[model samples]
Target: MDEQPETVPEPAGGLDRRAELSEFLRTRRARLKPEDVGLPDFGRHRRVPGLRREELAQLAGVSVAYYTRLEQGNGRNVSAEVLDSIARALRLTDAEHAHLMHLAKPKQHKKKQAVRTQQVRGPLRQLLDMMDGFPAYVSGRRSDILAWNRMAAAVFGDWSELPPQDRNWARLVFLRPEYRDLYVEWDQKASDMVSYLRMDAGCHPDDPRLSALVGELSVKSEEFRQLWATHDVKEKGYGVKRIRHPLVGEMTLNFESFRLPDDSEQTLITYHAEPGSPSAEALRLLASWGADATRAGTGASSR
Candidate 1:
C-alpha cells in the first residue's frame, strides 16, 4: 500500500507556494550548465538553457518523474531530506536554501498585519535626529521611508522632496536614475532590495499595498520582473555598502538594519564609517553639508 504524504496548512491569503517553489527551482536550474555541474555535453545541440531535468534528478538522487512532478508543483509531502538534497544539487547559498525551506513548508505563525501609517512617532523621529553623526532612517514593512534624519537626506539624497508615493526605498532603487549612480554595486544592491521585498510579500501575501508595489515595479523595470520571478528571498540585516555620493565621492560604510522594538514591523537602517578612515572624514563632511542644507532651505549640491 502506498503511504500518503503529510499535509500542512496553507499560508496566509492562500498564497501559491507551489507556484513560487516551481519558479524558484526553474530559475536555479536555468542558471546551471552541464559543465558547471561537472556533466559532459554529448555534442548534441541543446534546445533549452541550463541543466536538463534528468541530469538534475541524477545529481539529487531522485527519480526523473518525481523531480518533474516537483518542478510542476504537483509533488506532495516533500520531506526535509529531499529538500536538502535538492538544495545541495542546486548549490544554493545559505540564504537561498532558507528561502526554499520557507516556500516548501511554511509553518503558520500568527500573521500580524503590518500597521499602516506614514507618520513616524515623535520619539522615533527624535531618536533619528539624535544620531546626527550617523545617517539613519526608518522604513515601514513595505520599504516605505517613513522618516529620516537630516544626515540621511544628505547621504542618500532628499527623499522628502519627492512625492509621497516616491518616498519608498524599493521604488527609488528601481525608478530613480540618481539612485543607480549612488551605489558602487548597483545591481547587487538592487537585487538585495527586491529580494527583501519578496521575503516580506511571502510573509504578508494579502497586503494590497505590497501587491500594488510589486505590480507597479514589475511593469516599470525589466530587471525587477526577472528578479521577482526568481523567488529569491532576503532579510534586511547588517552589511557593507560601497556608495558613490555626489558630494562626498566614493566611500565604503557598514550598514545595519534593526527592527524597532516598539514597532516590530518597522526597520531602522543606519550607516557608519570606520574610525580614522577616509570614509569617516566623508561622513563628517556630509554632516556639515546637511547642516548647511538645513540652514539654506535648499538641498546640498552633491557635486
Candidate 2:
C-alpha cells in the first residue's frame, strides 16, 4: 500500500492576520487627505474619506492594484521595503511606523504567554526617592503604578489608598474626576494616555491584563472608546504637561519619560518646573507640604 501524504497546518493567527492588516490600513488611510499628501485635487466628489487608493499608490511608488490588494487584505508576504513605503505615505510617527511593521509581520508563538509581573527593584525605588525636587514614578507596561515616590503621590494623587489592581494611570484619568480636572489640557493628555496604551497593546497583543484594562475603559468611558478607535500610537517621551493642582493652582511642568534599561517594559517618568518660575515655587510649596505631612505621618494619603 502507498503511504498517505501529510498536510502541514497553517500558522497560528493566519486567519485573522489579513483582517487586522486590512483594518489598520483603512484607518491610517482615512486620516489623510489628498491635499495633505500633495496630490492635485480635481474637485471630484468623494464617496469615502481620506486619500484615495490611486493617490496613495502614486505616492508610495507602488502599483494601484497592488496597493488596493493590500488595503483589501489580499496581499501576502508583503516586503519590508513596500511596508516602509506605505508607512511613509501614511505620515506615520516612529511608534506608528513600528506598529505598521508589526502588523505586517507578526511573530509566531505557540501560545500566548501569561502577563509579566510588574515589580520595581529596590534600587530604582531608592533612586525615585532621591529626586527630592521632582515628582517621580515607575510605571509598568500598561501604565500601572508599580512604585512611586512621595512627591509623585503628592503631585499625581496618592495611589497607596487604592487597591494594587486599581493603581493605573488609565483608571485614574478616566474614572476619577479630581484626577481628570488636575490636567489643564485634559483632552490632550487623555488622548496621549490612550495612544500610549494603544502602542503597548500592539506590542503585547496577548497580555490579558492589558485586554482587561482596555475592555474596562471601553465600557466605562466613551471618550476612551472613541480615542482607541482612532488607532493612534505614541511614546510618552519629553513633554511639557500643564497641571491644575488643587493645592498648587495652575503650573506648567516639563516631564521626561525614560524606559528603564534593566526592564524595557518599565518607564520612569519625572516632572520639573523651570527654576525661579512660579511653577517652581509651587513645587517647593508642595514639597514643604509633603515634608509636613511626613512629619505628621500623613504623607501621600492626606488628600
Candidate 3:
C-alpha cells in the first residue's frame, strides 16, 4: 500500500512541503517506460517507478519540459486537459489521479466543511438562499456540505436544530442515529461515505482539519474506523440515494452536482424529480411537515 504523509504537522525544520511536492513527483516519474503503461517492455531495466518523464510526455502528448515543470511543481496554469492526459499516461488509479490534480495546484487552501472560504462569496450565498423550492447544497471536493438552501437543510435535517459543531452531513451520516435512520440503505451509504472520505483524505493528505476530522470520526465510530481500513476508492458525482426519511418514508431521490465555474473547489448539488412523481410528492410533504414540526418542537415524521 502507498503511504501518504499525515495531513498536518510539518517537519520541525520549517521547510516548504509544497516545494518538495514537485520533487517527489519527479522522482515518481523518473523510473518507467512505455512498457509499464502497456507499451512493450522491450526488455529494459529502468531506474524509476512508472515512466520516464520524456516517455510520459510523448504518451501524454506534452513536451518533456512541460511535464517536467508539472512534476517539479513549478508549472502554472496547468489545464484540466493536460492533467487528464498525464493521468492516463501514468496509469494513475482513481485516487492517484485526483491527488495528482490537487498536487498540481497546492496553493489554494480548501477549508474544512462548515468553515467558510473565499469560495462561498456573498453572491453565491444569495443564489442558494433564492432557491427555496428544491433541495440544494454546495459541497467542496471532500463532499463537505459547505452551505445548504432552506429546503436542502429541511430535506437532510434541520441544520439549525443541531449544535453548530455537529452540522456536517458526512459526520452526521455515520455518527448520529437520527441521520442514519433516514438512509434506506444505511450500510451502503456508510461504506460509500468512508470510501469517499478516504479518497478525499488521500488528495488532501496535508490538510490539518481534514486529518483531525478523520481522526475524530475514527475514534468515535467503530463503523467509520472499520470502513476506513478498506482503502477502496471511487469517483462519484451524480447518484441516486434511497432514503426512508423521518419525515417521508421510502423515497428515492436523484441528485446532480454541477461544479462552480468561479470557485474550483465548489460544486452545487440539487435533488429533483418530475412534478407529479411520487418522490417529488414526498419531498413536498416533507418540506411542509418539517416546517410545521420546527414550530411544534417535535421532530418531523418520516413518511
Please provide, for model 2 over 1-303, each residue's C-alpha lDDT reduced to its tens digit, 9 standing for 90 to 100: 011111222123312446656777889999898889888878889887998888889999999999998887764678989989999999988888887776667677898664445668878888988998688888877787788787777777666766666778888888777766678898998999898887787677655667777887999999999988887888879989998877768989999999999888889899999999999998888888874533332122333
Distance (Å) between predicted and true CA of 191, model 1? 2.4
Question: Candidate 2 vs candidate 3: which has greater lDDT?
Answer: 2
Best by the TM-score measure:
2
Deviation in Å, model 1, residue 206 alpha carbon: 3.4
Q: Global lDDT for candidate 1?
A: 0.77
- After superposition, candidate 1 runs with Cα above 4 Å error: 1-16, 38-41, 109-127, 161-164, 259-265, 294-303
Query: What is the alpha-carbon RMSD of candidate 3 to the true structure?
Result: 8.9
TM-score per prediction, in order, is 0.77, 0.87, 0.61
Name the lDDT value of residue 174 in candidate 1.
Answer: 89
What is candidate 3's lDDT per residue for 15-74, written digit by digit as tens? 233554464455446544565666676767776666677888888999998877777666
Off by over 4 Å in 3: 1-96, 100-119, 288-290, 293-303
Backbone clashes in candidate 2 total 0
TM-score of predicted structure 2? 0.87
> Residue 238 deviation, candidate 3, in Å?
0.4
